[model samples]
Target: MNRVEIDGDRCKACGLCIDACNKHLLTLSSDLNAKGYHPIEIHDVEECSACALCGVICPEGSLAVYKEIKPKKGG
Candidate 1:
């Protein structure tokens, strides 16, 4: 499973992260940040693939993702 984390303080609300997500997993928040910019949000967590493109595109480094590491079975 993949999870999304957003750094509210660091986000610039540039919408770059929202544009980078091809899966349409991200959205712009209705509320504005302290800088008066709409923060990024994820509407559908299931659609996310943990690609990390949003985090890479974000200049403010406000986004991050963590994918589950499956365990290997031992004989």
Candidate 2:
């Protein structure tokens, strides 16, 4: 499964990642982080392609996307 990991403390609630995500997988949390800012989270995670657009758009560099890779049957 593909997913995004966010360092809430490092996030500034910019919402850039939310806009960058083509799959609409990002959303702002109602609660604030340690920095007193609302952080982004992966909400619609059913089909995350791990495009890294969110990470790229994140100015704070707090987002990391991970995608699971399947091994080949003949390998």
Candidate 3:
């Protein structure tokens, strides 16, 4: 499983993540953050494929991706 984390303070509400995400898993928040910008958020984590497109397109580099490694058999 993979998770997408966005830093509200670092986000500039550019909506780049939303556009980069082909799965439509990410969306811009309607409410403004402390920086007065609508930060990006994942609407559905389950639908995310960890494509890393959002992270790549983010100009501020506020996005971080954490991928969970699956346990190997007979470890």
Candidate 4:
């Protein structure tokens, strides 16, 4: 499973990460963060493809995804 961490304090709620998530796993939270902006929330961690598009698209770089590496077959 991939681990996605969202720093609410730094998030500007630009919704870039939400749209960048290919898995449709990201959404803007209804609750406000310390900066008074809605933070991005990850739906299912198990469903995360670890594509890292959200992290890359984030203008604030508030999202970080950590993916487990699997050994390639027939290596």
Residues 1-75 of candidate 3 have per-residue lDDT tens digits of: 789888888998888788899998887888798889988888778777777899999999998887777899899
Cα shift from native, residue 58, model 2 (Å): 0.5
Error of 1 at 51 (Å): 0.7
lDDT tens digits, residues 24-61, model 1?
Answer: 88888888788877888887787788889999999998
Q: Report lDDT per candidate.
A: 0.85, 0.88, 0.86, 0.88
Our model 3 lands, by Cα RMSD against the true structure, at: 1.4
Arrange candidates by lDDT, descending: 2, 4, 3, 1
Q: Cα deviation of 27 in candidate 1 (Å)?
A: 1.0
Question: What's the number of clashes in each of the models?
Answer: 0, 0, 0, 0
* Cα-lDDT of candidate 2: 0.88
Best by TM-score: 2
Per-residue lDDT of candidate 2, residues 3-65 (tens digit): 788899999998998889998988889989998998887876868999999999889999888
Task: Give the true-structure RMSD of model 2.
Answer: 1.2
In model 2, the runs with Cα more than 4 Å from the true position are none
Model 3 lDDT at residue 5: 87
Give the per-residue lDDT of model 4 (tens digit) for 8-61. 889998998878887899888899999899888888889998899998999897
Return the candidate ranking by TM-score, descending: 2, 4, 3, 1
Q: State the weakest 10-residue window (summed lDDT) of model 1.
A: 66-75
User: In the order shown, what is each candidate's alpha-carbon RMSD?
Assistant: 1.7, 1.2, 1.4, 1.9
User: Which candidate, 1 or 2, would have the higher TM-score against the true structure?
Assistant: 2
State TM-scores per candidate.
0.84, 0.90, 0.86, 0.88
lDDT score at residue 28, model 1, on the 0-100 scale: 83
